[model samples]
Target chain A: MHSLKDRTAIIGVGATPQGKLPGSTQLSLAVDAFKAALDDSGLEKDDIDGLLTFPGTTAPEGPLNYLRVGEALGIDPAFTGSMAMGGGTAGALVQMAAMAVESGHATAVACVFGDAAKTGGSRFNRASGWGDSWGIWGMMGAAANSAVAASRHMALYGTTSEQLAEVAVACRRHASMNPNAVMRDPITIADHQASRFIVEPLHLLDCCLISDGGVCIIVTSAERAKDAKQPRVLISGMGQAYTTRTLEREDWWYVPHQKEALDRAYAMAGLGPQHIDVAQLYDNFTISVLLWLEHAGFCKPGESGPFVEGGRIQLGGELPVNTAGGNLSESYMEGWLHIVEGVRQLRGQGGERQVQGAETCLVTGRGMTLNCSNAMVLTKGEA
Target chain B: MSDHPKPLPEISDETRPFWDGTRNQQLVMQQCARCRHIRYPISRVCPECLEVGHEWVPLSGRGEVYSAIVFHQVYDKAFADDVPYNVSLVQLDEGPRMFSNVVGVPPSQVRVGDRVRVVFDPVTEEVTLPRFTPEDS
Candidate 1:
């Protein structure tokens, strides 16, 4: 099999203001983000030859597809498609763009995401189709689905809520350094504990915000990236894996398959956890960070709680995670912002939250009943 | 003529037998004919052996709480009065996990690893929901 390492690079990234911007439509936000990325890359709108879109859950009646995005942008791409793998879509979309670029199907690809979920009345409190059968018993919401795993993790590993709070605290601390973060207020473990329980083992602060936002990432061949604006951030390695079965699987909550995905990425990169200078682990919930930490081999299984305690995951710690605040405190672009943060960290553009002299970064994404998992290893390119 | 404001399960061709068994006061699951693998959320094909043949076998109705949570926030108004109710994932002895409430006890009292047995709650003339209660109760 041919390796995708360093063949393509991320030339630009852009994000819109997060949190309840009531009047803006998803298409408008998407176009705004695209324009920003275009300017950042010093690439004309005509330069884009591939388009990929991931619609937000709130736009059920009229979701953004590639055709709509192409029509709105006034350009036809040689390669394009919309994706729906939940949070996992962002990383996988970038991977698909890289493949398209490497395979000579397209020169420059744009992966975009836009959502008006917050203002569009997406409370994210409804039960999924699987949860519907048990809805009569009050089984509902993404919180409840994740709470089951959080509860089981606690019972099995003796992981306490305080340890879980460490994740929220670390992310919020990072967000305090970010001007664009939606929730920038620094919070403590006490604040996490005091917050009302959305579900047992998950506090209100433990959950990511339901925000209105958009993010766009531009990918091009390494040769083309060198000619474009901004420092090149190479896609060194990528991997994706998923499980069809859910609660019936014996190791359901543990989700060992995620580790398999990360392992493939590590092998492709010729690096391991020790080589990662910084990380952008997905954090739709606090427990997700713990799972990623363990699955990514940063710490042993069941030890993520202790690993995150005492500011280990905060900036200036041994391993700074989600330095751009993450989905926990950053605007929830699902997992898109995580990738953007990884790109910025590699570009030395993280500003106050920058991990000084950072070279290699790992970005992870998981979604859809906690089944789909993807990992990407990105590295700063030589000038 | 019932007035249950809560959302009810939508019985489809895939899940009809499971509901039919529950209405008749029995807990059943689709067991693969070739591999004898018990599946949940009833499907036509068995994931384990790829065998299309299956049997709606009766379950033991005895299981342990694999995990449980209490909802402090009501997602629906129908559940407003039931705020802080417990929802648990029960791992049946027959090796299938499912979502159901553990009744006959305070929501706070439920714990992981608690042994439970199935109990039927007939919500409407056509539907019966299976719940769990502590073995000791």
Candidate 2:
């Protein structure tokens, strides 16, 4: 029950140019984002005392391990580790950074996620090694796992394809205003329906873009953040939860642990879903956004279909989600950019798609076929 | 199906019995002797009761399709020829779930909650995979 409320603040956020960087390795991209974050925070590389990263890199040629990353960056940190929780690494990184800073383990931490899946080829697309034991076929990709969840939702709650399409349309609309987004063209529900199925119930459009990119966020004690260049975004509250079993778990559609994580986050933040001005919920697939909305208590269990309709999740609507475009339309950095976008929105740096006077932003990360998840609530300087 | 180059499962000490049962045309699961709980994707210990003592119980091989998906994209070159395959989760009658393919019907035609029964395909001399087909098929 120890609270992480306002103990640490994100002083800088940075990313490598989001599309395919043909010549860059994952380590180099990590360095690029780390350097940019340092520059943005007006802190020297020497200021960083801790390092964290995600071990699930799509790049086949580079070492994404934290020790190797530290060797590459020339920073021997006082505290260093890598999280292997897949997409949930982003929120987990922030939570760990806050704990490291708050408990006097480290003064400043640099958390980065980098991948060159587009250029190096996606090693994760194949079914081998660990998947063999579970009897998961090679053809069953991540989309297939999510499609099963979507199919269950449709069967139980009568969630329609049109309702799922709204999520894609709204995200693309938001991406249209974001220069960094890879797919900025405004797509309608018709376009979504017309898109070919990657997995039935999940069109190619419904899936997130595969791009080569890197994003980094710098965290420091709230007191040290006062002297940083940009407006500080406090890591007010955070939570992480995981299921013991993954895809074959009984409650596949509901994602019980994700709800627990969000409830813990909301409780620590002393706020409800109604207080969130914007959300950057992880959208590995369009259906994931709807599931997150429902499980996070933004809407009732079966009401997500109606809750997201009529532009409610758009920029001018009730809760503008994925304001910088999520993994769906924006550049995919394995949910790392979701955290960067949350920080940007809180700092009032979201250029054309900025939610006006946004005070509180909720960011989330989901991984391992929705079985593992983390949620964090961030606010702008004691707002 | 002869030309399909799909990757096969890697059987281990824990999972060998499950695969061995499929070879004999029986669907088996690990049931805890302590709690009478059945589990799939074989594990060393019972998740429910944390008991190392267990038994390999043959199930009725009948269940309902909890959910299904048709994959149109080729994730691996081995599956390039099998572009539109169905992958499904079957909730067994004994309270366990398994990752499998629903065969004997078009992938897109499969629906959630449809009754399914286990069917074995002995692809290689050493391995036999368990798949599902409609109960009445």
Candidate 3:
């Protein structure tokens, strides 16, 4: 009853195809994703009165200003700001959209984000070089950090190389059913084991795909949401939490305060773990799915190997996760495709692998240094 | 995390003791004397008690290999030549994990719960990195 049941609704969701777009510039994809979202809502670029994005992304503050998305479209935003939480930025973007509507600062808030990570490149970093930060190790990307966490998980639970292979195989199976996924071809455990090892305890298949894709959504007051193409997907609760940006903060890469962030979202929504019908978990790496699954209460800590290895997270499982193939099989941009997949499931538009009568979803983002995360709870919306 | 001729960490008044302690080879965990609770990463106040009385205490140098990662990919141009180096977090028995590199072992040999001890690599006249070596060694 405390949720945003009738408070605000996500009227439209839009995205570019999930794959490498060689010819596209970051700005064009950002603009196109926004244009498509508005079109889906039967609104215009002019209808957006607020904007949200990331500073570390390819389409920084300039692209929106250069295109004059506001002035050319005639909408003036009363609220505007950029966000940074590494992979957690997507859920934060959606949460900001809901807050904007709830506060009455803007009637229409468009939480727009898109990156040409595959086309351009991702320029993200961890640690501010504060006392004892490990910037000296010179890890350029997230691979090494995740590999470290994965190695620990393996050491603790006797996790095998084949078990991790199961992660990629399941993701590809789900992707094969999803026409939007990039790596739809089914891979065997042998193939995963044979795949190159980028980092110890982490093979090439265990990492996320680098591709250019953009996803955007428009949120508004429920009263006005009646006119949109889909029912109002009410924004229930949204939250974020960081344990420590530096990996050293946790005994392992596993953080203790993670539950509070998800708890805040669930509390605000008047829902619990059991209420979630599907999970669009952020998978910047395969181990993230394992760690986040346990961290998010789908399983116990250190139990993801048993949880996912059961194939329950795949098709016809109790709670469907990563239905758009996730970052594993889809494009990796803070799990943007997960948001789109959430919308698709709520709309019953998911074709073969659709969760039967799926309405509610829990989306989470993982894969920063440590103790950094974003989470949200969404529903099928009201018609 | 760096070994290049690049900028090194200049110890300020607040954190001078921490860097100095690493060089001299005695394990240190910062604590707020007033609250009797531990603090780490050289903060001004006790994260537990919110008290500003911080002091360093020597430790036993024994800890579990909470986790480790062997970096086969190099991000920095200066040290890209050093691939497959190991970076790990060792949870000191006294509490508080210090970001460090696990050395004296092959990258494939590193594992969680493997006993480790602190070892320092001299940085400059004033600083030495507290790297880790397997306790068995």
Off by over 4 Å in 3: A60-74, A123-129, A137-140, A245-252, B1-7, B123-126
Alpha carbon lDDT of residue A65, candidate 1? 72
Instruction: Identify the candidate with maximal DockQ.
Output: 1
Candidate 2: C-alpha lDDT = 0.84
Summarize candidate 3's per-residue lDDT along A191-292 as a digit string, tens digits: 998887776778889988877877777888877887677755766777677776353356436654567678877877778888899888878778877877
Residue A83 lDDT (model 3) = 64
Give, for candidate 3 chain A, the lowest lDDT window spanning 10 residues: A63-72
Model 3 chain B weakest lDDT span, ten residues long: B1-10
lDDT of 1 by residue, B15-87 (tens): 8888899998899999999999998867778878889999899998999999999999878878887878999
Best by lDDT: 1
* DockQ of all predictions against the true structure, Cα-based: 0.73, 0.61, 0.48
Compared with the true structure, what per-residue lDDT tens digits does model 2 show for residues A1-383? 67888888999889999887899777778889998899999988899999998755653433448877888899999998887777888888888988999999999999987888788777456341253543345445677777878988988899999999999999999999999899988999999999999888899888998888888999999999986789889888888888757544689556789888999899889988989999999999988899899888899997898889999999999999998889898987878999999999999999999999999999999887566799999999953
lDDT of 1 by residue, A1-383 (tens): 69998999999999888888979777878888898888888999999999999887755534447777778899799999888888899999999999999999999999988888888887777674353355777888888878988999999999999999999999999999999999998999899999999998799988999889889999999988886679989999889989757766878777677898899889888889999999999899999999999999999999998899899999999999999899999888999999999999999999999999999999999887778889999999998
CA lDDT, every prediction? 0.89, 0.84, 0.73
TM-score of the A chain in model 1: 0.97
